[model samples]
Target: MGKITGFMEFERLEEGYRPVPERLKHYKEFVVRLTDEQAGVQGARCMDCGTPFCNSGCPVNNVIPDFNDLVYRQDWKDAFTVLDSTNNYPEFTGRICPAPCEAACTLNVNDDPVGIKSIEHAIADKAWEQGWVQPRIATIKTGKKVAVVGSGPAGMAAAQQLARAGHDVTLFEKNDRIGGLLRYGIPDFKLEKFQIDRRVEQMKAEGVTIRTGVMVGKLPKGSRVTNWAKETISPEELRAQFDAVVLTGGAEQSRDLPVPGRDLEGVHFAMEFLPQQNKVNAGDKVKGQIRADGKRVIVIGGGDTGSDCVGTSNRHGAKSVIQFELMPQPPEQENKELTWPYWPYKMRTSSSHEEGCEREFAIATKEFVGENGKLTGLKTVQVEWKDGKMAEVPGTEKVYEADLVLLAMGFVSPVATILEGFGVDRDNRGNAKATTDFDGGYATSVPGVFAAGDMRRGQSLVVWAIREGRQAARAVDEYLMGFSDLPR
Candidate 1:
C-alpha cells in the first residue's frame, strides 16, 4: 500500500554500529540510526498483506501496516501516533526486541522482510526530537487509589495507563533507581539510563506518584537479588492504603549450576557481574567491582545474557573469552517452509560474538576445577541428544583454562518471599497463578490483588512485559469501574 511496486524496488537495510575499537572505550549507545530517507525506503517494502500476521506476531500487536505506510509517505508525526496507539515504550523495544513481526511479514516467506524494527526506532526517535511525546494529563479524577509494584516496563505501562484513566496511582520500587532490570541488568551501551529518566519525568507530570528505595514486602534472608531499599512497607500496609494492588515485578531468581567448586570466589552470577558496571557508569563508586581485565573468562550458557557477558569482558580487556552451549549447533539458515510466520530455530550470532569469543556447542560442564578457593578452569564433556535426552560422550571430556566464570543460564522465577508475603497463589512453575480470561483476568486468589508480566508469566521479552501490563491495567480498570475504556 505504500507504493505499487515498492516491495520489488527496495532492499532491506539494517541499522549500523560504531567501530568496535571506538565503541568499546565508552558505555554509551553506539547504534547509528537510519536517516529519514533510508527509513522511508525501508517502510516502502511493507506489502500491507490482507491478513497482516505481523500484527499478531508482535507481542504488543502494533498496527504495523498503517505505520509503515505513513513512514513511507514521510508523515513521521502520524506514524508516531499510530505506533503510540498500541505500544507504550517503542523506544525500548525498537532497540532490543527480537522482532518477530519481521519474521511473520509476508515477504519473509521467500525474501528478506521489511525493516520494521528500524522504521520503529526512527519513528520513536523522531517523535522525541520533535517534542511530540508529552504527558497526557487526565481531565477528570476517578479518586480510586491503585498500587503497582516494580518499576520495570510492565509496571511503568500499567501506571501510565491508570494515570491517564484518572486513577490515583503510586508506583513502588525496591531499587534506589526507578527502573528495575532496565536500570541495572541491561548494559549501558545497549540502552542508556537517560531514556528511563525522561519517561519518569513524563510520568510525574501526569500525576503518577513514584516511590523509589521502598520495598513493599521483605525478601528472603541472604537473597542474592539486587535491592537498594532503605525503607520497608508491609504488605498489610499497602493493601489497606490502596483500593487495588498490581504485582508486576520481574523474574529475578537466577538458575544455578550445582557442580563441584560452585562456591569458588571467581564464579559469579550474571546479575552480580552486569549490575556493578552499570552502577560505576552512573557515577556511583562501586567498591572492589568485578574485574575481568587480563583474566581468562568462561561464560556458561549461550544466550543474550551470555553474549552480554562476552561484550563486557572484552570491554574490561579480558585475556580470553569462551562460551558453551549444551545443545547441538543449528543450521545457519532456518527451514522457512517448516517455520513460516513463526519464530525459527537457527544459528545466531550477536555483535559481541563478532568482537571476540570462542563458541563451543553440544558441551556440558561436569565440574569446576579451582585452587586457592578461586576458579582456575572447568571440566566439560561433549553431549548428544537422543529421544529428547542428553548423553555425554565418554572420550570427549577435557579441561579448559579460566580465571573467571559467569553463569548466564537465565532466570527461573520471581523471588518467592515477595509472593508469600501477600499470600498469592503460585502456579506449578512457581509463577503467580492467574488466568488471562476476559472476566477477572489478572486477578489473584487474594481479593483486590492482581499479577502480570514476569510475576505471572515468568521471564520474557520487554515487549511481552508491556503487553501484559497494558492488558492488566484494562482488567484493573474494569474491576474498579463497571466498564473500562482502556485498550487491552
Candidate 2:
C-alpha cells in the first residue's frame, strides 16, 4: 500500500500531449510525461486492495502496487527494481501499451483509476534520466548459446533475459535496425527511435549480440523485414549453429481488401506506406516515399493502424483525410458494474482521432472506383448489425473522392517463409502453433525451434509481445540447463 489514504487525497493525472497543430508539424514524439511530484502523488493512490487485479490484468504482469508504494515513499532505486522484476522493457510499454492495468485498478470500481501507466512512464523516464538503467550482465557463464529470431519486443526481451541468465545470446533481425515493427511499422511520431536505441545499447552491454540485416530460413531473393538484409540463413543451419532458436518474426501478412480497382496505382497496404515514413525519419532517403501530400487520403479500418494512418496523413499535409469503419459506433461510456476488473467494450478515441479528420462509422467500403489506372474515389454504404450480421442499408450508398487509399485493416499472419522452412505447425488463425504450459511452453512443432510474440500469438500489443518473449526465454533456458532462475 502507498499513502494510507492517498486515493482520497490525490486524483488521477492523465498524461499530457502536444496539440495536434504543434505535434503534426514533425515526425517526432510529443507526449508530455508526468512531473516527479505528480507521479509521486499518483503513486500514492494505490490502495491496500487484498487482491491487486492490476498486476494480473497487465499482459506483462507488471508489479503495480509494489512500485506505486515505492514511488510514494520516494524510493526511486527500489521502485525500478520492482518494475524490472517482471517487465523487461517498461519504456516500450510506457509509450505503446494500452495500460489494461488502469482498467483493472481496484479504485476504478467507484473513483478514477490510479494513474498507473502515467506513473510508470514517469518512473522509467526518470530512471533513464538519472542513468539508473544499465547493463545487468551475469558474473558466471553457463556456456550455452541461444538465438532469437526477430528483434521485436518479444525477441528483445527474451534475448536480454537469456543473456543475463549466463547464456551467450545472439538476436537476429531481418531489418537493418534491431526493432522489428517498432523500427519500421510504427511511425516515429508515436515512439521516438532514440528510446529504442538506448535500450538496445544497454542490451548490447549486457552481452546480447544483435545481428541486424540477417534473415532466417530459405527466403525469396527479395524477402526481408525491411529493405535491409545482407544475408539469408536457413532454419536447419540456425539449428545446427545455435543451441536453441526462438521464432518471433511477428505476423507480417497484411489483410487485403479484395475489391474492384484493388490494383489501382495509388492503393497500397498500410505497411508499405508506414514503413517508408519511418525510414525517412531515421534519416534514410527512400527513393520513392509513399506520401499523402496534396492528395485526398482515405484510410480504411478503425483500429490503431488506421488511426496511425490518419495521423500520418495529417502530418503529410494531405488535401483531406477520412476514415471508414464497418462496425457501428460503440457507447462512449462502459457499464462499470458489468465490466469491472476487466477490459470493457467502448468507443476508444485516440490522439490521432482528435486531430482534424472525418470519421464515418457503420459504413462498409463497397469498392475502389478508379480512373486512368489510378484510384479516383471509394464506394461506401451504410451498415447496421442485424440478426448477428452486418447488413447494408438500401439507398445509403455513396462515393467520395480519394487520390491515395491506405488499407490499414491489420495483419493476418506471419510470412510463410520460416514456418514452412522449419515445418512448424500453425493454428487455425495462422499464427505459430505453441502452448503456454509450464512444461515445454512456447516450443514449436519443430524440435529445437521455439516460438513467441506476435508471430506466435498473432496481432497484439507490444506489452503482450514482451511477456511472451520473457516467458519463452525462461522455457528455453529451463530446457537447456534442466533448472533455471529466469522469471516468466
Pairs of residues at least 3 apart in sequence or in different chains that clash in candidate 2: none
Q: Give stretches of model 2 more than 4 Å off.
A: 218-227
lDDT of 1 by residue, 1-488 (tens): 67768899999999999999998888889989999999999989989678998899999999999999999999999999999999988998888888999989989999999999999999999999999999999999999999999989999999999999999999999988887788888888888999999999999999999999999899999898988899999989999999999999999999999999899889999999999999999999988899899999999989888998999999999999999999999899999999989998999998889889999999999999999998889999999999999999989999999999999999999999999989999999899999999999999999999999999999998999999999999999999997999999
Consecutive 10-residue window with the lowest summed lDDT within model 1: 1-10
Model 1 residue pairs with clashes: none
lDDT of 2 at 329: 85
Which digits, one per residue and each the tens of the lDDT, describe model 2 over residues 1-488?
A: 99989999888889898988899899888889988788889988999999999999999888899999998888888898889889888987888888899999999999999999888888888889888898999999999889999999999999999999999999999788988889887778888899899989999999999898887875545543354778888888888889999998888888889988898999988888898898888888999888999999999999999988998998999999999888998889889999988998899998888886888899988889888898899899999998899898999999999999999888888988779888899999888899989999999988778999998999989999999999999999998999779988
TM-score of 1: 0.99
